[model samples]
Target: MSPDRGDRRAVTAGFGALLSRYRTKTWLGGAVVAGLTVSAAMALRLALSPVAHFYYLPVMPAIMTTALLGRRSSVGLAIVLAIIGCELVVRRDSIADTLANAALFIVVAWAVAEACFRLRAALDAAQTMARDMARRELLLDSILTSTPIITLDCDGRTRRVTQGAAALLGVAPNGALNQPFETLLPGFGAAALQAAQRSDGASRTLWRASRRPNGDAALLTVAAHQLPDDADPEHTVLTLTDQSQAEAARRRERELNDRLSSVWRLNSMGEMAATLAHELNQPLSAAAVYLHTGQADLARIGPVAQPTLRTLDLAKAQLLRAGDIIRRMREMISNGSRAFTEERAAQMIRDLEPVVALIGQDTGVVIRIQTDDEDDHVLADRIQLQQALTNLIRNAVDAVIDRDDGQVTVTGRALGAEGYEISVRDNGPGIAEAQMDHIFHPMISTKTGGMGLGLSVTRSIVESHGSALAVSRPQGGGACFTFRLSRPTESEIP
Candidate 1:
């Protein structure tokens, strides 16, 4: 059971085999025993009777036990045999000699037992050490095989990547064992080796690498640990994790936010259309009347009449204005499924014209556009910027639709080197101070039937374009929503 006991047994067996092969005479003790046996046999033959010297045979059992059995059990058996031998060989007629032989046997047996105890202790210690080694091996094997992270063992030039390491690294298997690590992982391997060398005495170290393997766009996060007593400082254990999935998830979240925002703007457009239909219908009816008058006058004159021509020109201008409003309305209602993207500043404002016109036509609230300082071109997605601006104008309209003084002012200007600012100011009830921060968050709206995604989406788009959107009360008790865009460069300023 014990390592020392087992080792001793193996050695003894091997020695016995070698001794048997030699075919030489036995050692001094064995020779003495053999001679004794011969003399006893001859003596028995001469006396014509049996000699009771069976005690001598006990030595054979003791020798065999010492070689084959473990220390404790063997020594115990030897001591018992020695006592029995003393009893068998010492004559009962000589009491003193018998006692002396028994005392001598105790002394020899005690010495043998002490030796056996020390050998047994040594064997036990060795077995315990072997068991501990086996346990550590099992623990390491489990860690290597079951962990999701990749692990590698390297000795500077050579690296051994275990099974599952390749899968984690998103790389095809190359013969990792005994091959140069650089050959397996190329550029990363060199950096990893460099990091490993620097981290030899460090308890913890982190390194970031932004590179795509095999032309794939992904970020790799590598972690390394140096092994104890490592001959080469560059020999380390490496683990790789890809951050591509996390980045993709973030993009998806942004897209979902855009879609939800688009939905909210559409909802607001519906309300705005309902609110402005009356005002727009009245103007359209008046324009139709003016056109009819101009047409009738031209028909009667049948030739170029200055007054009739002037009337016709005015009618044509009104018609164009009416047509522009209708066109803007159509664009607002016509939803395109293209994903929202960043667009230029000039392009973003230009796209909102149609939607702004539609809101003016559909709502009695008068809309005004003003610009003080000029702005450079900006980056924004066309439709998204359009939707955000549309939402702001509509919100302004709704805020003051019932008031005789209802006015929505759209203004723009440059903000130094940072960007351009486009603001929607309305003469309406201002937003409560408590609701400022929450206004941009989804599902927090003051309007009826509002999903509250309008402001939220607006902010998202603004942020995406390296811009910002904010809300505050204007000088005239009204709500104002302002968005800023980064200042454009020489090529982009147009």
Candidate 2:
């Protein structure tokens, strides 16, 4: 039905547009019609001249038709044709009467021509207005289709539905129309619909959670608007904004922020740790040299005191171990983490639990370890992986140390045939946005008294395995540090 109406308007619009150009065609049409009509009227008069007096009766149709085609200019041409015919046919005895008759014919022809001309003008104007309206309606339909909005009548039936709403409801646009509010949205009530209709544009709204027709859950924010002094009191417009997209976007933002913050924190800690290590390196080296000299001097002295010599040797070994630990911490900045080897994921987690427990033992924090029964075979530097996991667990333990209900969880799970994902979490206040900026800033340390090297070393180990250590805070109040370790494919395995 709409297509047919559109076709008719198109034709009407085309007809007017075709003749509107200011060309010689209109004048040519007027001249040709005047010549032909005058010729025909002359023949009719010649036959009636001997019988009766018909001055202007034969040319009225010509004037009206010409006026319809060429407007005022055509009407003047038709009047000229009438006067020529009168002059050629009038007799000497009937000159005055012929003159009076010719004058009447000109006036009558012009009036008829004027009416016809006005009718054509009005038709073009009306069609132009109709075409404009059609274009506006098309734009309105496009808007309704893309936006998830709908209109409801006072009878609680859908008056209109957008294309987006139709897809969301699992129905065709027309199929969704005229449906009761309850039918379209299960659990929707007439009272709420009426309340929305009574409210003026966005003053009233509701949140609804319901399964769609396709059995998928949807979260919708419903707001309604009714125009003031509307002709139909029940007519209301409703906006159903889907909130799932918003939630997903926020989750993604949090993950990105966590990863960025983790990188920053590692960089800052590494620089400061290097500074501290530098200051301590020379003193520790000098003490080891002194201890070695003391032990040698005792050995050369004839009779050595065994206990004193043993203490000197142990002291030198402790100094060497401390120096090695400092070197590993510097790896975070130097990218020196290497010596990758195949290691059992579960076994590594089991080995690290004792160290984690010792840290939290006196702090009264509950330590929980979750390891996969079927341990994953991951390609990693065993010592480095252990170092990374220990740092995270240690950090998690520190976060919850002050709380009476302090709990820390260490988890390791196989990632299909890939390898394993390991994480450490604690029930403590999470990192804030402002803290993210300073996380990677050199010299900024979370620890108040002095800087630490654990995080810096952990970052190096995780990065060596081709992954980042990311940290995120859950809504329930906790910090989580996560990283993935992969296994070599059969061909890449040693």
Candidate 3:
């Protein structure tokens, strides 16, 4: 086929498809309008027969027909109307006048048809836009209704809820439309609502609300979004998400962590038992030798001699040392299961003098004790507090054992209004910067053959008494370990 014929066929096919898309009701309405146009035109012509010259009466009906029935249908009606009007009303005295009158009617009818086609096209576009908008609104409504989140929109001035909000609030759909927001969600307080409304932007809060009367409540995370400043009355949008399950899961996780920590502490105590046994062996062996030598001297020179008295005194000192070692081991084995009491800080330090002296003599390090306030007292487990101080002093002595002027000083001072601070400092190389982070962790050591449980156990003991053990480098060049304990009440103070 030729190109022009093919183009014409395509155009005709498209027009037929467009016309077929319209329903029967549209075609019937178009036909009725066309009939009305023609009848109105004929009646106007007849009514104007007695008038001198009324040529434009039919133009109004022609324009109406064109606008309603479209260009093709209105053009056909205009042709027939022009013929009927010219034959019934115009005079045939002059052929030129009759032709002129017919030409004028045809020109007016064609102009009206063109204007109606343009208006119809505009109307079709408007109808298509309306349908699209309606479909989009339906989709949006479906999405909002099907979502799990509870959504509510409130009027800024009246605080009345809409139907969408009423559904979530468990109230009648239309009944909630004009009611106050507080009435719809009675559990949500007026103060919170007012705060949400007055918020400048989106605000978030955790709200606990009961789903039913006399039932356990759920934790809901609510987010409120304030509308723009230019909006009338200033509306706010609220969205609620349930967080009850998440909170419960987090609580369970914390409980599990605490159990794991307890298990770890038990394992650490088991490892420390072997170290305690080895530590006790030295004092126990010394006590046995002193007792044996004292018995031999009593048998040889009797109790009155100077040698016999010295031997008995030495045996007594060794037995006391052995007893102190046993007490420390018991405290460590109990692992904070002991009861607490009000004890003088100076007395606790004084009790450690024998152990400190033994460690200093063995390691060639001088140990000194200083007290700023003699009356300072703390609420703590006496055995456990002594054990913690003993660990600190031992570690300090070991740290400075290699130096010519090795010194370990234990200081007790009154702190604040109701606290006492005790510190153990050593004039030796400070803790290395790299080892500072894990200094209290199990199995982390700086010295050779060190089990690394001393500081960890010491910290555990201090913490059991409700205080933290802190380590820092002193200005004079050495490591200092300090802890603060709450002072005893005035009545309990010594």
Taking all chains together, each candidate's TM-score versus the true structure is: 0.43, 0.55, 0.44
lDDT of 1 at 66: 43
lDDT of each: 0.60, 0.73, 0.68
Q: For candidate 1, write residues 1-494 as lDDT tens digits.
A: 45798787556555544433432233443444434433443344335425444443345335333422333444444555555544654456677866776677666655655664555445545555656666997998787765533334444454555555555444444544565555545465656556655765232322233233665644445566666654343346666555568767988999789769866866786668645754576677677777777677677776667677766766565565555545444444465222333345655565456557777778877888776434545554555566668778888898898888789998877676776788989988899999887788766689999877678767866676666787888777889888786654555433
**Candidate 3 per-residue lDDT over residues 173-234, each given as its tens digit:** 55655455555454565567667666743336756553533354666655566656544353
Best by TM-score: 2
- Candidate 2 TM-score to native: 0.55
The runs of at least 3 residues in candidate 2 whose Cα sits more than 4 Å from the true structure, single-residue gaps closed, are 1-24, 35-59, 71-73, 83-93, 168-171, 180-234, 239-264, 275-323, 334-494
Best model number under lDDT:
2
Among residues 3 or more apart in sequence or in different chains, the pairs in candidate 2 whose N, CA or C atoms overlap within 3 Å are: 264-439, 264-440, 265-439
Please say which candidate is ahead in lDDT: 1 or 2. Answer: 2
- Local distance difference test, candidate 3: 0.68
